[model samples]
Structures are given as structure tokens and as C-alpha cells.
Target: MQIAERMQGVSGSAIRELFKLLGDPAIISFGGGNPSKACFPKEVIREITDELLRDKADILLQYGATEGYMPLRRAYLDYILPGNGLHGELDNVLALTGSMQGLDLLCKAVINPGDVVLVEEPSFLGALQTFHVAQAKLVTVPIHTDGIHADELEEVVKKYHPVMFYCIPTFQNPSGYVTGAATRKRIAELAAEYNMLVIEDDPYASLRFTGEKVPTIKSFDTSDNVIVLTSFSKTISPGLRVALCFGNKDLIRKMTIAKQGSDTHSPNLNQAIVAEFINRGYMDKHIEFISGVYAKSANCMIEAMDKYFPEWVRYERPVGGLFIWCTLPEGWEADKLFRRAVERKVAFVPGEPFHTTPGAGKNTFRLNFSAEPEERIVEGIKRLGDLIREMKAEM
Candidate 1:
């Protein structure tokens, strides 16, 4: 019954566990960052999948290279990277079952137990878990509404001299904050200066509804210390489990070896489908359509919150990404609010799991706006607001 010491303090994803509560048909969930079902290009995917089965089944049904299905690596180079102001050859890319796998593989490839790994104070919970399981000594850098300051980040790097830094620079999870372009460039610089490898987990950059498209940290990685992980989950289909990462060739090779030990290889059929999806010029149009759908849902939720919630509860109107981070009044705990919400057939993620520092984020929680219908979003927010008022009255 001995679990490895690496997993001693690690726990399952709080969001994944929340799916258990979603079995009730009446519960309007805002817990997981689930892209709208409407966002999936079902017809296009069906058409592509059919063609792949008929034409490429021999290759796809067989074991794929641990490096990835070559076409996907190539498609990413041609279609995905250019928009981010990046370019990479095949050796620089690796296909992932999901972007989360990229983090795990990176950890396996590089981290030694107790090595310092820096993260945004409030980061993606899944990534945090991966680091914990890898036994990386987790450290935090503060991020604000404007994202982290380059000078401040440099000070932290100077302090810890970490093995790597993990961040979600654009439309960051839980908080929906975006690190600006100038700071991203500086981050690339800090990585080189300290020989720190920066893991840029950028699953939501393509989801921007407003604001200028900022450059990724990898774009400025002159010393090749930054790696960028991009996913089709938010843009195409999460179920497909297709994602890719571009980085230093040496690092990618190490990760590929690590990936082999884990999944052997990512599913070839899924990689081929996504590769064709990109090559056929379907990616951009699909992003536009889905972005519009999510934008409407986000606006509806915000409008409902404004009309229903008290002024003391604070959050920003997100320009993109699936979440709205809310902070309740000081000394109020959101896990308590979550309990009351579920009783009313509503749900959201309490913010504690997303934070690395002790006792941080007790007053905070995250609401995902991408999963529910517009009307359902309104009703959920109204019910949530009502519960907050009811809980306060009892207090």
C-alpha cells in the first residue's frame, strides 16, 4: 500500500473531481473550463475522420512515433506557429495527448526531486498537480490584473534560480489574466540569463475576443530556453486530445523519450485528424465561430451578475478565455459559498486549489462561462447571487 513519495502530497484535479457533481441534469455547472459543444466543428471533424479512416487507416491504426505523427508536427509548424511569430522544424515539435501531458513529460525529462519550479501564484491547477507529482519544489511569483511585471519576475528568478518556470501567459486559467508582450519578452530574457527553462502553457491565446494579439514568450526565446504548449481543445475538440509543443530540439527529444515511457505514443488517428483540420484551412474559421459563441455567453453571464450580485463581490469582464475570477468580501470563504451553490443546483471551482501559497485564495473562486447556454448562464448567476445574499444573511 506504499504510494511513491512523489505522490505523497499530490491530489487529483479539483475540476476533474467536480465532474462527479455534474451527474445531476439540473445542475448548471461553471466548474470545469469546458468549451461549448457548439464550438466543435462536428461536420468538419466527421468528414476528416471518415477520410482518414478510408485513406490512412493503415498508418493511423498502427503505433505512431513517440516524437508524434509527422504531419501534425509539420502542420503545426506551417499553420499554428507562424501566427505566434515562431518557426520550428520537426525535431523541435512533439505531439501531445493533451497539453497537460506536455507538462508531465517536461517534468519527467528535466526535474530532479526538490528542484525549484516557479509558477504564477494562481496557475492552472492541473499543471500545479503535475509539478507536485514530479516532486518539484513549487515556488510562486505574483500576478496582477495586468499580469506580472518583468522587473519583479527578474527579482524572483534571481532569488530562486529555478530549474524552470511554468506560466499561462495569455488568458491564464482561473484568473483570465494576460501577460503583456513587453513582459513576455523580458521573461524570455530572464530564462536565458538564469539558464531557466520557461514553460509557456498557452492553451487560451487563440480564444481572444478583444485586444491586440500579443506575442508569446517563445517568440523571444533567443537562447532557446522557452517552450510553448498549444492545444486544440479550446479551439477544436477537447475529446480529440490533440496538442503540440515547440521548443529547443534537445529538450523536445528528452520529452519524447519521457512521453514514450508514459503513453508510448499519442493516438495517431487523433493527430492525423487535427493535422488535416489545420492543413485544410479550417482552423481559423472555426476559431472565429467559437469565439463569437463564447463571447455572447460571457456577456450574458456578466450582465446577469451585474443585475443580481452585490457590489462587494469583485470580478472583471473577461475579454477572452473561459473563466471569470471572483473575490468575495475579505474573510469570506468561497468553498462555503460553493457548498450553498450546489444545494441550489449550481457549481463553480473554489480558488484554493489554484493557489500555491497557504491560505491564499480562500475568498476567491472561478466561474467558467464557456460550458452552459446563455439562458442557463443567466439562471446560474442569478441563483449564485441569491445564495451569496442568503449566506450573508445567515452570517
Candidate 2:
């Protein structure tokens, strides 16, 4: 059997591969970016699901509009967008199965083979894989401790003239870096000036535990070139696979058409569930509650890393989001460390696959804090740190 040329070099996700190890209850995993099981509002979701099936089963079980379930589109525009300093009409919103589908849809709608797509260095691996399957010419701009530098972004945009720029502006995945408001505005402006499409994947924005809220790039967008992909996977439930993209009406319409052939519209029941969650005044309160849970977890992980790891191991203390990005000393291999750590029943994602640039991030790795209990988090760090020391002793 012949496979498509676009998928020729693409491999399975490294994170998904790590998931197979998670079946061992003995293993303390810091690998996948998963929200804590304790954080899910199971009761509320059950209640919402019951109510929807009781009253709205006809509409939900039937074929939904390719555009989306109408209530979700409105809920996003009226309830969610204004809080983020964005406003859009129904044509601007498209419900997605997950934010992952938003990337695939955008690539289908706008990206042709060989079209340039610029991404942040160490951006979401899922997005990278989608772009790869689309056979895009991938370019990258570096993200620092703070976030993507505006000057570097402009340099890349000017050089590559990319058709799209993908970013996780708030509480970025894997790295947990937040792009500043100024750079965000500059990004919006650059997108307009260059006629480029900016895909702002913001699943972790509301999960902030510390630091001031930054305005989204779409909030600064004037030319309708910036699109915001919002996910309920972190804030609500990943199982539901509910998310939406807000952007240019024309682009959205294209994606909607593309989506018609994709999932035939995101599951209507899931979309309704999210809409009901927002409309029932439970959204903010739930976020506030889970934010506290993740905050404590993040603090626990940080304190453990400080207490257990050697001084030479460097990592950023994330203000928000699930993962803590760590860089080992130069010449150290995180892949080797991962192998050793897993033998001790501890797991983390080796960082090299997260980078599009060849041979980058080999000395780095990412740890997820939101999935495990505090005890597990501390234990995982201790095991990883001990293995690092053992590896160093051999050198």
C-alpha cells in the first residue's frame, strides 16, 4: 500500500508514544500535557449533558450546520470574546472538534503544498504535525523566556513571506512562556502589513495562576488577519473535544466548508455542552476553581525541582499552563535521560521532537505539572533529578 507523499517523513507524536507508558500505575509521569482528573467538573458536565439530552436531543442528534451549533457561536462571541477584548459576528466563528482540528482546517482552507508557515520554535507538536501533513514549508522564530521577540518575528516574516504564523500567545504549551501585550499587538500589525494569517492557539490562557492577563493578538488585530483558536480541553473537558476558531469571515467560511468534509461539523452535543457551561454562569467560577488547583500543583512541582535537582539544571517557573520546560547542561541528552528516568518509573517528554529546527532541544525536556498529584509530581522530579545526577557521574 502506498501512503501519501505529504506523510512521507512525518512520524507519530512523541507525546502520544509516551502515553503507552502511562498505563503503568507505578510510573510517575510528567510527559503529556493533561489537565488534572480532580479538576474536571464531572457533576456539572453530567447535569449539562442530561439536561441537553432531555430538551435538545432532536437538534443535537441530528446533523449540525457545518458552521457550528448556533448557540456555541453566539456564546463564544457574546460570553467569551469580549472578556478577551475581541468581538466578532457569527460568520467569524467556527466550532471545531478540538483546537487540533482548527489547525487542520486552516491548512486545508488556505495552505497549499509548499506554502510557507512560520511557527514559534518548540511550538505545539500537534500543530507542527498538521503543517507537515499539509506539506508546508515550515519556518520558525525563536521564543525566549519571555516569549517570541517581535524583532525576530518581523525578520522571519520578511525573509520567508509566510502565508501563516502559528503562535500560542498565552501560557504557551510545553514552554509555558507568555507573549507580551506589545509583541502581540505588533504581531497583529505585522500580519496586517504582510497579509499573513496568524493562528493564535490559546488553550491555556484562562489557566493562569500568576501574572497579569495579556491581551490576545486578535484583540489587537485591525485587518482581520489574526484568528483565535480557543479550547475547552484544558478549562472544561478534553474528552468532549470542543473548541472554536474566531477570525476573518472569508477565512472562516472557507474553514467551515473544509469542516463539512472533515467531521461534518464538530459533535453538536459537545458544542452544546460547552455553550451551556458558559451560559449557565459556571464558566468563570469553574476557571477560578481549577486555576487554584493547577497553581498549587505548579508550585509543588517547582519547589520539588528546586529541592531535588542539581543547581546546574535550568528551567522556567511557569506562571500558568501545564508544562515546565527544562534545559539540562550543554552536551547532555534529554533522550538518554528519559530512557533512564523511565526505568525508575518516571517519565517526561524529550524535547528534541518539539523543535522543527534540526538537532535543537536535545539537551531539553518538558514536565507536565497539572496531571499528577503533588506527591507524584515531587516523586517524579526526584527520580528524574537522581537519574540526571547518575548520568552526570558517568561523564
Tell me the tens digit of each residue's lDDT in model 1 across 1-395. 88889879677855567668579989999988889887878999899999999999999999879988999999899879998899979999999999999999999999999999999989898899899999999889988898888887988899999999999998899899999999998999998889999999989988888978998899889999999999988999889899999999999999998888899998999999999999999988888988888888889999999999998999999989999989999899998888878888999999988999999999999999999998899999999999999888988
Clashing residue pairs, backbone N/CA/C < 3 A, model 1: none
Error of 2 at 221 (Å): 0.7
List candidate 1 stretches off by more than 4 Å.
Answer: 13-18
lDDT per residue for candidate 2 within 1-395, as digits (tens), equals 99999989999966577667569989888888888999899999899999999999998999989888899989999989999988878988999999999999999999999999999999888899999999999999999999999999999999999999999988787799999999999999999999999999999999989878998899889998999999999999999999999999999999988988888888999999999999999999999999999999999999999999999999988898888999998899998888878889998898888899999989999999988898888888888888888889999
Q: Against the hidden true structure, what lDDT does model 1 obtain?
A: 0.91
Residue 148's C-alpha lDDT in candidate 1?
A: 84
- Clash counts per candidate, in order, are 0, 0
- After superposition, the stretches of candidate 2 with alpha carbons farther than 4 Å from their true spots are 13-15
Q: Which residue pairs clash in candidate 2?
A: none
TM-score of 1: 0.98
TM-score of each: 0.98, 0.98
